[model samples]
Target: MDLLEAIRKRRSVREYTGEPVDDAVLRELIEAAVQAPSAINQQPWTFVVIKDADRLAQISRKAKSHLLKASLSEPAHSFREMLNDPDFDIFYHAPALVVIAAADPTDWAVEDCALAAENLMLAAYAMDLGTCWIGFAQNWLATPEGKAELGIPATYAPIAPIVVGHPRRPPPPVPRKNPDILWIDAQTHCA
Candidate 1:
């Protein structure tokens, strides 16, 4: 698919068909992710690909439990309510999860990881695959036990937990908000 087409078509797919993504396709997505630019060319990121169905289910359960015990701030009320649903799966039963981590806890770590994540999502869309960044798993995946279970290094920070799979159906195009642009000419700046 063309770059623009991929960008326009990419959406946060919550529902998946339970079909496992091919290993080669998953590798290509990760390759696309790493191709993303990083701060000062410091490609400080690590990726953990989880394909085990049992482990994915376990993660969903743990994340939901953690979310329920979290403080009920007004902004989080809706999310808390969603977690209350016993059948709600944070990953939406996606067959694969690509957990992107910051290799070092630098100031630009999160930003760097975000760029890679966007690349991965776009690449997946281009390949007729679906992806959703699971923010609810961030806190839980960073905990000691979470890290140990996932085998993430102590120095690495779990930045993006993206679930990947085949979409049950292609989502219709959604409208985009107008761009907020501010153009300043060089001549106007020198007062």
Candidate 2:
């Protein structure tokens, strides 16, 4: 797929076919992720691929519980309702999850990992695979128990918990808002 097409077509896929993502394909996606530029070329990112069904279900349950107990903010409230529901899987039942972590908790760690995540997502889209960043899992995955379960080092912080799988169907194109560009020429800047 063309880069532009992939960028435009990359939707946050919530529903997956539960088909197992091949190990080779997952490795290719990781390779694409690491190719993303980082601050000062630090490349301070590590990945934990979770494929075990039991582990995934356990993480989903724990993360949902954590979200339910969090403060009742706008988004949290919405997620709380989802947690209340018995059928909703926080990971949307995707077969594979690629947890991106920052090896060093620098100021730019989150930003650096986010860039890599975008690369991974786009790469998956190009390969006809589906991916969704499970932001709801972020806080839980950073906790001591979460880290221990995944064998993540104490210094490394989980930056993104992205689920990867085959889409049950192609997601429709979501409408895009107009770009809010504030272009300023040299003369305009000087003025």
Per-prediction TM-score to the true structure, in the order listed: 0.94, 0.96
Quote model 1's TM-score: 0.94
Question: What is the per-residue lDDT of model 1 for residues 6-31, given as tens digits with 9 covering 90 to 100?
Answer: 89889999889977899999999999
Model 2 compared with the native: what TM-score? Answer: 0.96
- Model 2 ranges with Cα > 4 A deviation: 189-191
